[model samples]
Target: MRYFIIPALGLISLNTYANVIQYFTGISYANPAELFKIKQTELIIGGTGFHTVGKFEGSVLNFNTGQYGEGSAYTRTTSLLPYGRIAKRFNEKTVFAVDVTQPFHSNLNWDEQAFTRYAATQTYLTDIDISPRLSYSLSKQWYVGAGINLNFLQNNETNWALPINPTASANMVNRTTGFGTGYDLGIYHVFNQSNFLGLVYYSAIRQNTSGTSMLANRINPNLQFNFSLPATTVLSYVHLFNEKWLTNLQVFVSEWDVNQYVRFINTSAPPPLNPDFTFTMRFRKSAAFVAAIRHQYTQKTGLTLIGVIDHGPEKDEFRPLNFPSDTQYFLALAGDYRVNENTTIELLYGYGYEKTFMNNHVQVNGQNLPFTTGKVHLSANVVDLRLKIQA
Candidate 1:
């Protein structure tokens, strides 16, 4: 949340997830040894994604009755992110690859006239990373890999109801175009021909952003802030019953507790609006589980079913407006097609549902913002398609 006390007015709570709640979540994919089976070289292109549709509803309170009131509905829409990978097997025991992907991304908008406008209006954030990796097979059953990441992050947000004038709105913009560096390491092992295990770890990324808060009339410049992306670890298991039936289990963990508060620097505000202030971010260390089963119908085609259970990052009571649900469930169906000896394609479709967060509320500047506290409900549909070429 980006709420603040105005210079001449009362406390104003700004629900700005664009900057606070939208930090790096976790790794999009964790299979570094996925290309060990590629013959000599592989080129992947055209990342097709089915967008996520989020429906939001903010609950409001009636001060007169001292009770919570009804809420209004809003929706958030986003397109699929870009992803690509190119890998080359230099020898029987070594492989090299490069990947381009958007690991963290979000964009949302609210009705300007809605009761929840003061807490949040608009938010957009994106992070792009380019990775170069190398993998080696120490023996026939053991494999190891590592990668270097170059990251680029950007953010912008809008909030309404400035303390100076309740009807007024404010916008925030920042300059975060510098490249950051991080690394990833992975290990893979095969037991006999039926059991396999894999694990990957991604380091944290520190980003320093500087910018200002813009109002309808005045510009608040000379502001600076710093935040670090959380670290993540993933573990996976694969079981092959036969050539036609296989199963996979994966676990993903994110260490968001490492950095849960954001410190803001404003050199100009007086006393109460001192040079340094902090806000509790809406995130916590969490883990998710995925189960998948694949069936080989023929040599040229196959089908896979995947199910996911994600315990969201926010706790119920402390959850912010940005996190509408505490948990999410998803089921996906995927189809694989062997276009030819050199080309392969995969398409996946999924449906997800979020458990509603009810009676949600937050206090800013020690003031209970009933209007900003409300119930939230959301659900989504996702699609993904990718192509792989080998030679």
Candidate 2:
């Protein structure tokens, strides 16, 4: 006979958690299912700091190796994003929760005199999500959950202000803001004492943005645009090998193809010259795989190791300077400590690596311009700290 003691909420899957700076897979927060799993009323606060550094080595106009100066080397930058969640159990079978998280964010800055200024100098994006969720214990072994999301988005970019002339290049800014809505559905099943499966789905949203565009400090009111955030689905499984050892498996699929193009409409008071601007962005469906292991070395301490690989979405078409993404891989180590009966602290360290394929072609005004380019190398480290208090 085999006997496995299952503690109150022992060996929960950790795959539901995501890397703080993952390649563009739309904006999604850590699965809320994990928050309600143990039926503990708790408040969790966490923050992630991602230190990213990269360089662009190739020529902007497909010329000689030294055609452009060393300005292509960018300076390192770090971004901090925070998240908070609170879950309360109204009854043994019902749970309510609220979450505030930064779903998607990025800031790419280049050297002030980078030759790529004509193409791109800087781009910043921010997305905030507010969610409310409800979970029901359908039965002893089954559970269901649902939630709604309100997302606010912002886009800001800076580049050479040249419209038709390349010699008269100046600094310019383009900015916009919008909002959207989405929903989430989740299911969890405990087949036996040692096995568990969880699934979640998040819907897509469309944002229509309008803002002013500045050229050398001059404002232009013809900077309205629109884009779509893709939907996502995740599946996770957990297996307990013994009372002290456990493993988790996770698979993610995101529909990122909807972000193919961004169309700018001129809404100026008086008709401006060429009030319509359209640009193409190459994006495709993507998937990722994750595996993790956890060991409860003692009653008060736990250690976890995680590895992830993402098959990023990209196309042969011209890649933009703002959003540079490719296949990504990561390794992470984490530790959890229980300070007391009502408090827990978790700390994580992760490293991410990516190499983007060279864009052998460029696009302008829906026209394809051929050029041989060099590869881009990107790397970042993410440090996360979280405090959870059970009330």
Candidate 3:
């Protein structure tokens, strides 16, 4: 029931969506289940995304006044990712396809002189995914899908304002790239000509990363570490009310609990020079719900409406904040026009808002730890343009 202007990223590589406060959980034009009825070879190319501005207000302990103060973080950013898909039918029962997308993304930055500066002054996370897959008809009403993954992940965090002493400050940073392989499996079943169901799963991938860690603003030690990307499952359903109306619903489940901390260490460095840096990012299991309704008003053009609700993983008590996130709602509109028998073009525009509640603590030498709770305002809009061609 909650509706607002939150940006829906380009949905193929995305709404195929957002990461960080979210991980690709939004209404999309491309779902793997879209191949269910394609009898011929097809290609889809598109671009999606927009810009965001935010204001951060939080509780902070003031040393001189011995009272809590508010507002320390601010950010403005723009994000746009790519998407493409190619599906070719080998037989009546088998279809081969390749999808190129950026599955997950997160970019949240904090100013250098903020009260919440120690945890991270900068944070970014995203990945590129290429999957080649096959969907085969098991029967007149059932289809099965399998695929292989080539994934590349990138992560960066810069920790600043370490309270080494009253006279000085320190900085720490860890930036790395992870590459690995995984698998995708899915099943699709249809009850009739107008209705069907789909389920797909993506396995967790291991990132063996090599990068440098900046410790205490001095030593830059080369380090290595291994981290895991969370596995995900999606269930989708579609039904046509009549010749002119249709609806699609999807439930996305993510195993975000599998991720904890990425610890980096230098094997060859001396004890004094050994810098063991750990990036803490912990989460609980989460899910998102989405729906889309399409109405064809003319022979050459159609319109669709989309809605989504995503529950974030961070909850209860004090946890080091990795990204500001909470329950979010989104609404989007898309219109499509057929250029010819072989081509179709679609455009989507959307917007949304996020009100965040956070409980966080900072490391200090004092006996009493001050935990802060506050709100984050994320303002952004979404726009996407796509073209699909068939033979």
Pick by TM-score: which candidate is best?
2
**How close to the true structure is residue 29 of candidate 2, measured as C-alpha lDDT?**
42
Question: In candidate 2, which residue pairs get closer than 3 Å at backbone N, Cα or C atoms, i.e. clash?
Answer: none
Of candidate 3, the 10-residue stretch with the lowest lDDT total is 6-15
- Model 3 lDDT vs. the true structure? 0.64
Name the runs in model 3 displaced over 4 angstroms. 1-17, 20-36, 60-69, 163-165, 215-219, 261-274, 277-282, 318-321, 362-368
Pairs that collide in candidate 1 are 3-14, 15-119, 50-383
Residue-level lDDT of model 3, residues 28-130, one tens digit each, is: 2234544656778989887667676667777754332334557657877777777888899888887888888777766666675676554345656667788
TM-score of each: 0.84, 0.86, 0.84
lDDT of 2 by residue, 174-224 (tens): 677889999999888889999999899889888777787766545677577
TM-score of 1: 0.84
Worst 10 residues of 1 by lDDT: 16-25
Between the candidate structures 2 and 3, which one is better when assessed by TM-score?
Answer: 2
Which of 1 and 3 is ahead in lDDT?
3
lDDT of each: 0.62, 0.66, 0.64
